[model samples]
Target: MRELPYDRLKAYEGQPVATAGAGKDLVNEPMIRHWCEAMGDANPAYRGPDAIAPPTMLQAWTMGGLSGHTDRSGAYDELFGLLDGAGYTSVVATDCEQEYPRPLRPGDRITFDAVIESVSERKTTKLGTGHFITTRMEVRADGEPAGTHRFRILKYAPAARMTKAPERTAAAGETEAAEETEAAERSKAPGQPEARRPRPVINRDNAGFWAGVETHRLLIQVCGGCGTPRFPWLPGCRGCGSPEWHTVEATGAGTVYSYVVMHHPPFPAFDPPYAVALIELAEGVRMVSNVIGVPYDKVRIGMPVQLEFLRVDGEWELPVFRAGGGVAG
Candidate 1:
């Protein structure tokens, strides 16, 4: 990401950011329907009769819509406004990836809780200063999780978002006055350290998994009641709703289920043009990790992989997998 001046980063801090407001029944229906059609996903589940919402619809709808739980009037727009107030003028939606647990239909009231996943200042570029920001939003209906939204925003601008005077527009006020200071602080304060991002907090659901990682072994939860496996250390089989479960050592061998080649430097921690894969392990469990020791072109469906460990920011160890054929960088 190209960075903006500190003045730009300072522009919008302390502004009130909100994502509130009940919207009319998906005025974006046509756009979503068109997208599905263009993608050739003519399944009845998302067509005329079934006409169910496409799994990705949540991206376009709740992006700035009525779904996610925020105090802002528009989710996407509100996020931009808040960023602008902080002085990040060149705001771009770097990418958005989503996982669907269930389908969203018409007439469902959507709600979500968004968390700042991470933030980083980048090395200066010829274009300008850069900052990589990531946010994770979990959507729910009633209380059950419906999906997770991973959003990456890159800002490149000449001016910062927040400052002491905040664009001294003299009519007895400033941009700071037009916007609520409370909004900019919602995600981050201008120039604040990046540690504020919400991360995977350890608890009963996933304690053992991390323990095994500390011992250089990978563990997955096996539901004794329903015979299902899970990750992020869940309490029970998401399949049968059984809470009884045990741990199993991963054989560390698996095949790729789905993947993508990330070209953009959306997250500062991760390098560009890396292969990110969801591998199905020998235990019939799928885990998300970066494919190390292999070139992006060589990654394909059903490629073989083994387990490796990467030390992420937290004291906990992150489990990364390596494909069997090639050695990683």
Candidate 2:
């Protein structure tokens, strides 16, 4: 019997993918401050004297970045070459898991090593058929065990493009055919049902925001400490590191600060080529939402919009902005 492709991939497991690698820079407060600012993290533990790096930033210290690492072994390249030869060339990160044994602080020198942890059997997914490859890296800070990071990726051939069926036509003499064509047209009408949009993620931090949507109101979070308003509600204020906040109803006015048109790799609920805009509200806070009441191509930066509640399906309600002075929520 011929050996399967999965069997060949299994041979690469438990092999060293990289060894004796060292971080390009030491753990420093400057990089930590930049990361916290970008992530909107205002926790006091990450700032001031006696600060520590965020636990989730473990992998960041050991990355080779754009310069690429010279310590990487040929086994990693050979594994990818095999997959490419088998016509599975596309790749996407699935997820990652990490564990911290000790806190990483400033002035700590970092080093790491990685190995091929596993190769899974062939499986079919919405993206296509592919194998999952997992790698585990052990990280150390100043020669002490600091953390472990496990990353998984999928290498697959992309699925075929989706297409719609041809529209049916009626013939002059065929009465039954004409009736069937009419029914088909009715089924394709705009009033017919559609796949529901993905539901919003509601946690304690953002529950108030969704509750406001249910009540047909737009709410912005205002920090009690600094009086700064913020959107996409955070648990704490970024400006003054304050967790105290209150909600204020918006005036339903905004402008497009930035926008993008999505057109590739269509999903079940979203039609491609639609405009998603970064809207700056009248209250000086920004949020991302879809722009309606205009064609996708007509959406532009600096376009004025009014807030409204959009019911995409039977149960879910979302906040959207309408261009051209459309109806308010």
**Best-matching candidate per lDDT:** 2
Best by TM-score: 2
Q: Which stretch of 10 consecutive residues in model 2 shows the poorest summed lDDT?
A: 180-189
- Stretches > 4 Å off in candidate 1: 1-86, 90-200, 311-316, 325-329
Q: Please state the error at residue 45 of candidate 1 in Å.
A: 20
Model 1 Cα lDDT, one tens digit per residue, 105-172: 65566666665555555534322355666767677644556778888867655422223222222222
TM-score for every candidate vs. truth? 0.48, 0.72
Spell out the clash pairs found in candidate 2: none
State each model's CA lDDT, in order: 0.59, 0.80
